[model samples]
Target: MADEAQQGQLVNDRYRLVRALGSGGMGRVWKAHDVQLDTHVAVKELLLPSGFSAPDRADLLERALREARSAARLRAHPNVVTVHDVTLVGGVPWIVMELVSGSTLQERLRVEHRLPVEEVAEVASALLRALGAAHAEGIVHRDVKPANVMLTEDGRILLADFGIALNEADDGLTGTGVVIGSMPYLSPERARGEKGGAPSDLFSLGTTLYEAVEGVSPFKRETKVGSQYAVAHASVPPPRHAGRLEPLIKGLMERDPDARLTVAGALELLAPAKPAPPPPVSPPPAFSPPAPEPPEPEPRPASAPGIRAAAAAPSESRPSTTRPAPARAASAGARIRAGGRTRRVPAPPPRRPLRGLVLFAAGAVLIAGGSYAAYQWTRTQYFVGVNDGHVAVFRGINQELGGTPLWEVETDHPEIELRYLPVYQRKQVEATITADGPDDARARAAQLALQASACAKNAGENGEDSVLTEEERLLTDRCGN
Candidate 1:
């Protein structure tokens, strides 16, 4: 009942074809769902041309099945498309591959023109690793073209379309070595009707990189035949956009397959292009504080308790003098006045020696009195604690052992048992027991005893055990009497 199935044309009772993803000369790809896995997958159905006989359809069918096997063999590779299932429906072979969500390298080229050198290096690096994996498994990806390379939405570059590639034991490739891939990516040896090897795959990789950086295939020509000719005879044009990657590109598409860049060499060349570590962020600038206003001149001591600052410096009351400074200095030095000789007045008597002594003495006496009062109050305070299963009373809030016990009492009564009370309640009872009046302390103890006795009777009526200590249970049970 799924809307994705093509009018009851579903396959294997598992995959339901949804829509056409793409189509090539060999097969048409569909976005399909695997009912068993509950996930999306790509289904490729091989199609025979209209004029082809039944035998041609059969041959292509076998080829598609073989391509599925090839893709399945490299399942562990991250850059290689995963082959999930291969099955036949209605006498047609359908290959299920991973549903990669992204645009083809060729499509990206149409938009981006040419990739940046760093980006191309990364793409090439991924492509080389995929090829290396396939080559290691004795498989050759005969066709490595822009359309066969996929740039994923997550920034991963993948190699696709290994249909024409064959395994090591497949002797079919040795027969005349007719080029099976696109012309631009075909090496010279394969174009000249010779065999292609691992090196030939590298040449295709170089051509792929060259196009990625140059925005055009290395051996593109007007027609397929011209392209084949150029693959064998034309020179790979110098890449202006390749920059640091130009050498690797040229090395990979070398005319002689033996001279081309091997997978290892290609990896070496792209090593520097690995994305560099991100730059460290810097902390924000700190604010410079405003300078403090100059301290106000200490006010002149006006009363008995006030403290005065240093000697009153150069009073503002001095007569304003501009041109008279020299005359004043000469008169002071000669001990002479304008009309009669006179003795110079001595500098105002050195400021009173004990200016702030009285204030400091008063402050010391007040501090001594406050400290003594605090000491006496601390020694007068009392506290209660448990020691050796009995109530221990101590003097002073700090409970230091500078003195003997101030008071000790039996803690066997439920009302007085410190252990039966929560920490805060126990502290309150200790304060009440040590109240200022002995009569008040006794009254509080009697009130607490009556409350505990009532709680004990309630526990018995409810058929619940009391939480009080065993000694407290005896005291509470006798309290009502």
Candidate 2:
């Protein structure tokens, strides 16, 4: 990586770079100042890695420049990321545009896991509006994912990353068998090596929105092979949230493109009218003001021309108006009569016992304790107690020595020793006795006393390494711990 100051100096005379924003496979984007306009803009410089041949470099530059110009046409819409100009500095292609202050939708999704249904609807509506604008202009955004959507701090949504966008007028630039775009968000038709359309972009948007609402995309799998299979035929599951809009999310995430709602159609489905709040019970007091007296009638002229003028004049008669009259208030004796018949508020019902939780916990504890006891009993076969602090196995022994189990008889103190003793006879190993008690010092004293009454016998068999093989190690890794 180069220093920020040094990288900014690489801009042409017309544009002064500020800082490098980020870089991708084909280009690096920088925040720069357009010296001619004195405004901040993002300059995307196309760079073909050394791996590409000269011919490939020329093709990439031309394709990138053409796409940038096509994206510039979408600047008329507010939701679409604006592209300003395309230029070349030292024969390398570059694009200048408005700088957006926000994190990518990908970053948001990674942190949030999934959004609520209403939130999903809001974001999807914004995205669809942007897409509708582009599709109207015959521009198809080949790649649509959370990474390409910019979410501003103030909550405005902007569709970005038009690097792979295709203009309806331009000839095909992508080579055959080369599938572009992110695999998880790719439409089924695109995954099958077909040219993507507005519907294809909508499908990608559906997948992105599905993940935003469901915590996982419908077509996601642990392996690329599995993902590919899922894209071919699998339908994504509905969002886990039980809000009012779960069905709408399901509609958007349908497997068949035809079954999915169109962008305009989805906008309507997502934008719901909020319920109006109830009106207050108390009414404002009514006031009575004296009405103005009727205006005095004007005198009429006594002539034929005056008679015609009087006929054409507006009505002089005062309009009759009616006002709502105040009703009479009840007397104190009438109010006292009505108060005696008021109904009493009922008391709450008695609380019920939660038997379900108590039974479930009891069952769970029994299963866990039984499993632990069975595990402990199986481990006692190989080793026998030599003393309070040690165990007597065969002549040889091996242990991974992960950790020692704590003694539960007294307190759960690790210092307390527990053991199993093997009683030996002439040239034979006999029964084993288990003991777990208090302080380690006391246990050791008891072990020494027991040892005095016992006699040493022939050693048992030797032990060998049981470390897992390489194949088993790989299998465990794949299965997940």
Candidate 3:
């Protein structure tokens, strides 16, 4: 069959093979054109050994049909690949499915070594949704691995290849004492030849996500048998690069299937934590002046010749108490009478100069000068950093003064996403790339923009369509598709 399968060959006179997309031990997949639908599709060709017994051939054929049915059952699921039809040509079953332009997760890991923690979280969330949908239909995707997950060109994560999926509606087709799953991703129960359930699938997903962010399989050994043993009994090594995803991965990879994390639990762990709102600001209080103290009477001069002091007035007739003052008494110089002689006392010393007013004026001048100098210094300083997730140039230092930021965004490159930049460049942006002036800072930001564009382009070439905003789309367009 492998020799006979070639480009231009029509399957059941409907799907015309265009090219080989990929091949594995079980079968080969091809990019094909559907004449009836007038659309492009993927056709998977199941290949059996030429020397199979009659019963073995029939069993394999049944399994292929079961795979088609399982995928078709979840066709409405966005995260699961859609199965179109199944046809037989030359006694071989060919599965026709929707054509998705993308590469497998395994292929991506081969080039990137590992993905960022946030990106891995996104993948895990999508896969968890897909698994939840399948589990709802009483289906367990026995084979969940990096190679079976697809990252489409349209920023979609899809689970593919339901060849070994188990459906509760159908009688179990797997024979006893047979373990049918990748060794590294197989759950302990499955590795020990037990009939595993949804938990087993979860374990495989955990392994896949672990490898996605850590660049190494947790329990993978040197050989298949050794790896199987490790899966059955080995302790999962701690991940050094998983960041916040470490807990979720560890929970999913638990040795006890019953203790393993569920889809709901994993979703909870993946949910982004909402930031707390800033405390409310209160307005300042109004001001009021203090009350004035009453003036004290001046003491009488001792032994003054026949002079009567103002305090010597009779208590009962002390200016009629609260009555209006007499015109003569209101005068600045009031006379005192004693022994029929009239005398005058010097007027109170001129009010002291307002020392506080002079000090206040001096302080105002100093503050104004200091503010002008600070403003001038800020104009001369510039640095490159991130502003709301975009690369930007700032006019002052990244520090803060009295709870207020010292820097202001001078030029923001909205098209350049800070997260997409390479690790080294991201670190530089986070630490604030200093510059001699605004122009120099802008140049540095432009360099970071180019790096971001290059990174986005590489991701597209590798079939990883990262979600982007309108501004980010402009950057992607600059990368020429």
> Of the candidates shown, which would achieve the greatest TM-score relative to the real structure?
3
lDDT of 1 at 145: 85
Superposition error at 209 for model 1 (Å): 0.9
For lDDT, candidate 1 versus 3, the one ahead is 3
Question: Which 10-residue window of candidate 3 scores lowest in summed lDDT?
Answer: 472-481
Over the full model, what C-alpha lDDT does candidate 1 score relative to the true structure? 0.66
lDDT (tens digit, per residue) of candidate 3 on 389-425: 8888888888887898888988888888977775545
All candidates' TM-scores? 0.52, 0.52, 0.60
True-structure RMSD for candidate 3: 12.8
lDDT of 2 at 413: 21
RMSD values for the candidates in order, in angstroms, are 31.7, 28.9, 12.8
Question: Candidate 2 has which clashing residue pairs, if any?
Answer: 385-420
Cα displacement (Å) at residue 94, model 1: 1.9
Backbone clash count, each prediction separately: 0, 1, 0
